[model samples]
Target: MSDGDPADDIMTATYRALCTHGYADLTMQDIADESSKSKAALHYHYDSKHDLLCAFLEYLYDRFVERTSDPAGADPAAQLRSLVQTVLDKPEDDREAFETAVLEIRAQAPYEPGFRERLTRFDDYLAGEFERLLEAGIDDGVVDPAVDPADTATFLVTMLTGAATERVTAGRSVECTRRMLAEYVESHLLTDATEAQL
Candidate 1:
């Protein structure tokens, strides 16, 4: 809205700077240097780093929703597999910085209400996805009837996000985690009826 998407440019620049310097070390000048926007334009759009970072965090979650939504007509169990694989896939060198940046943003959630709001919304995306998948699986007779959709949804998100946290913070082996998740999903989440049928 303000002068030919300068805000977008600034946000893009901010993202680059964020991945490079991380949240703690990133500076306005760094963002400015990365952007085509002038320093004044950057200031006009975001007066402070916290404001910019909150926007950045929101931007990331929004991008995730846009990119990761399961394909239409995919089986619910397959959708669940896709979701698990998406989170559990091993980190590529290029993504390490961005993944680290996401965790850095997550650490701010407890203290910053605005940041917390965006994070909650981001979580809703996963939770909602889990709910839909759980419903579909139940309807299709793939997931166990005894499993409560809401509880399982929470559990799936927790497992996925916990894996993400470990990947960034503790250098967890994603291959190991993915194998464990697949086994757990098969043995626990998926219905015995489906297994017997197979």
Candidate 2:
């Protein structure tokens, strides 16, 4: 669905409702309450809550791609930092609740093939981005040539996913995780010259 359309409105409402009520407690009525639409209208678009939530997952994936399509930095290190920040940056409203809801959705991925597929796509996308950046950095002599782009990308994605999950599940500090990631970049990814510069 395109922006400003009825379907887009439904997605937006779903996001708000999910953030407020979370996955388990979210209802079509709650989603409709966030939008100008009624519960009947929501049902008209989505036959059931399951269908609506699946659509919402697609919306979130699209938004994530759009958000990170452009990595904003002069160098690979800076670009990597920016990408990670975009993922970890807290929402202005319902910050904790939003993260908790995301975690709840992720927990359901294993049992739900649709959810698992969509979530895997997200990880693959991020890993591919990381791979590109790492390859570029190596070519430019900014990153260690010994670093395997594929393996490093997988490590980075796993680390980032863990950091996001930890923030809500274990009261871990995102700032602390950010610093740790920075350290990983400097100590492992960067070339000797780049590491010395930092």
Candidate number of the best TM-score = 2
Worst lDDT 10-window in candidate 1: 189-198
**lDDT per residue (tens digit) for residues 1-198 in model 1:** 123576677767877787899877888888888888766777788878888888877766766776568634357877787777765554343367867876787788899888899998877888888888888899999888788888888887888888878878998866766777788778888875233111
lDDT of 2 by residue, 33-119 (tens): 999899998899889988888888888888789888777888887777678777767634436877788789899998988788888
Report, for all candidates in order, the number of backbone clashes.
Answer: 0, 0
Q: Which residue pairs in model 1 clash with each other?
A: none
Q: Model 2: what TM-score?
A: 0.89
Every candidate's lDDT: 0.75, 0.83
Model 2 shows how many backbone clashes?
Answer: 0
Residue 82 miss distance in model 2 (angstroms): 2.3
